[model samples]
Target: RNDHMLSDWFRKNQEVRIYLGYAPEPNWWSVADLVHVFTGKIDGISPSFRNSMTCKIIGRDYSAPLIDTSFTVAYAARTSSQIAKMLAGKYGLKLNITDTSEIIERDMYQNRKEWEVLQALADLEGFICHVDKDKTFHFGPRQESDEEVEAELYYRSRLKSNCQVDFEDTAIDVYNQITVRHYRKKQVIEGSAKNDALIEQIGQVKERVIYNSKAKTNAQAKEMAQKLLPEFSRYVVTGKAMNMAGNPNLFCEKKVAVKGCGRFDGNYYVERFEHTLNSSGFITNLDLTNLRPDTAQQYRQDLYTKDSAILGSGNKLGSGTI
Candidate 1:
């Protein structure tokens, strides 16, 4: 393509590294200031021989294969961190995870994708999983977003001109109560969590019930539901906060607060974001909550991947609420 030797040299399984860098203020830029943002492999390449010759290339982050490409494995009452390490090591990726005491019940993926199993485990424990540019896999409880940092951003909105809301969306899945029912050795066990304050404010209980949970005990089931209560509370205010006023630090998995925006004033999880810099200056775009379809797909697969029996006796297994 481009008649450049390197551009046409792409082949299967070749490593790729990408870095993002900028000058630090008035100081001259150096390689030390660069941040490694992506590491991947050339999973595919296609050269077109048309009138205007061109080429197409596609790849994924390095940890993708490590997480998504494995097969048959089993775990019985294994701890969360233990399983994470095992999976990472299997693929030769470095593991960076917070240890968890949560023990997962017996499970067999039956040759399913490794990510499906990990995602199922994550949902059951109300945790999260991700990887870094160095192929370092991470798993554990989701980190709490800094409210003070988010406050600083909203405060700067009045001064910055480009910071304006571009789009917003709200999900109807917001609920005050989450009920989880699972089959425990063929007996139905149930656990539920309630947000009394939310129910009171809404004037009624908006409930979401999930069947075939992976939780092994009543407490585990309840804890899974409890973790979702606060997340759903924030859904009422989910929406993209137009252009943020200042160059504020923002990233996925972080929480941002929008204020002085009427009913939209509330904390929201920054699910996705984009940053652009040019002669026009820097711009920040954000996607909050379920505005993006990937979040919806993730929820569907993560919550329902585990094998479970039907809600009642003498019935067949089927997909349940996620």
Candidate 2:
């Protein structure tokens, strides 16, 4: 009573409407459309086409619909045949008999051109030339032997008439020319700057010496100050001027005098003046830090000699009295 057999048949063979149109005011309708009108559009119909009937219900012609389906099928079959032939030819299977003549003619032309190029290349010596995609020639290696120089020359002359040199060689020549020009320009600019700097340095040294005098002192102090001033000036020229200007802490300072002689403590030459004062029979003490270390030692030894001479003179004078 459930009709399982009927439901199984409907599930296996589903029915679909293949609509076809009739020509001359082309119009058509499916079987289901007529059936739906007759059955009140309520119950389902069986999926079997065995009891199906084709009814030419007389509203419009259906020839246009038939012609359209036929044309579509024919076009699809022709396209598939063309695709199959293309695939066979690509795989070298010769699917179409008519394509052989054209393929052989193309191969023959290619082989003949390649053979001519090989012969030309084999005949060259002293200079070998090749043609590029842009139809320009390049010359480098020689293919023929040295003994075949005449043949090589003949081939070279023929190639020269047929091909022009490549743009690459022209570009290389231009690049080399530009590089040489750039190098010469750089050398000229650097040389001029160096000359200008030398002149400026000479002028600065002259001005510095003219404006400043050597520190006034006896021979030893003068020698010490002279050695120290240049190094100090270089520091001032390159360093902060306000800090090193008159800052005596950055340099050595000294004052020296005999007890009886008036103070000879100017800015410099204290040690030499003290030695002279002590030799003249006055006791003296001199600060020696104004001099460099080696110069200070030498000055101290001179002062001691002066003191010993004075004491010796005083002892001799006292002995004369006794």
Candidate 3:
């Protein structure tokens, strides 16, 4: 049904390259104006419904070498970082791996996808692993320090002019406690960590257990457990934010902040994000995980005062604010 060689514009397996740039803000230009954001192949094309006959094109990056390619036999590396490097080399992909030098007694892939093996390695070392734009692969411990955050987003309902979030989920992942066990030689070491703030907010117990970890000592086990805490309890506070500011500086495995939203204000890790720009407008959609659920604060009414009641369940005048 294609006319004027519409289907010819996108051939099967044809390489598709996309470059994105923020429209200059009032005659502002910079050296890094446009970026080569995507490199992939044309997957499909659909009919253009409008008078202009805009073709609906779809494509995906060759980001599946790790996720789809699998091999048999066991290959061992002294360090998980080394294993990641070996995979990156074998796959001819770029790497940004970090802090995976922990020693594992017995760990090797047995006929599994490269990505699954990477995921298992990450879980063992309390890290994160993924592929991003430009077919760049990443493997690293979760970002927790504020100094590493790339963006700070703000949204206040009162300030309708400054809109950043379209949909926000204050509470979702409920695992508040984690227990990790490490088997090293004949000695069996175990440690546990808790999300005190989440427990305070939900007033319940949600537990998780991790086995065959990279923890060596009891302290290391506890520390690893702590490092792995937010992945469960604070990782998924907000679902997706439609960037109102048209910012395209977002990336996965990085940290972003949402503020001025009570009980939901905290730093979030970008699990997944994408930027869509066209003739109509530009939008950067973000799938974030809450990193600092503890930052959520509460205000209570004074019990002694006649103005407000004490802390109690809702439907009562003496209840507290959440």
RMSD of each: 8.6, 52.8, 10.9
Q: Over all chains combined, what TM-score does candidate 1 have?
A: 0.66
- Once superposed on the true structure, which residue ranges of model 2 sit more than 4 Å away at CA? 1-231, 234-322
Q: What are the per-residue Cα lDDT tens digits for candidate 1 across 151-253? A: 3234334554334543334334457898876655457677899989878877888886654335778887798778756765544333454454323355554
Selected candidate, larger TM-score, 2 vs 3: 3
lDDT of 2 by residue, 87-193 (tens): 22332332322111101112212223332222222221112222222222233332233112110101124233211111100111000000000112113111100
lDDT of 3 at 169: 45
Each prediction's TM-score versus the true structure? 0.66, 0.11, 0.67
Whichever of 1 and 3 has more TM-score, that candidate is 3
Q: 267 in model 1: Cα distance from truth in Å?
A: 3.2
Residue ranges of candidate 3 with Cα displaced over 4 Å: 1-6, 23-32, 44-52, 74-79, 95-108, 141-147, 156-160, 164-172, 185-187, 194-205, 210-214, 223-236, 292-322
Candidate 3 pairs with clashing backbones: 235-289, 309-318
How should the candidates be ordered by TM-score, best one leading?
Answer: 3, 1, 2
The best candidate by TM-score is 3
By lDDT, rank the candidates, best first: 3, 1, 2
lDDT of 2 at 73: 18
- lDDT of candidate 2 at residue 227, scale 0 to 100: 47
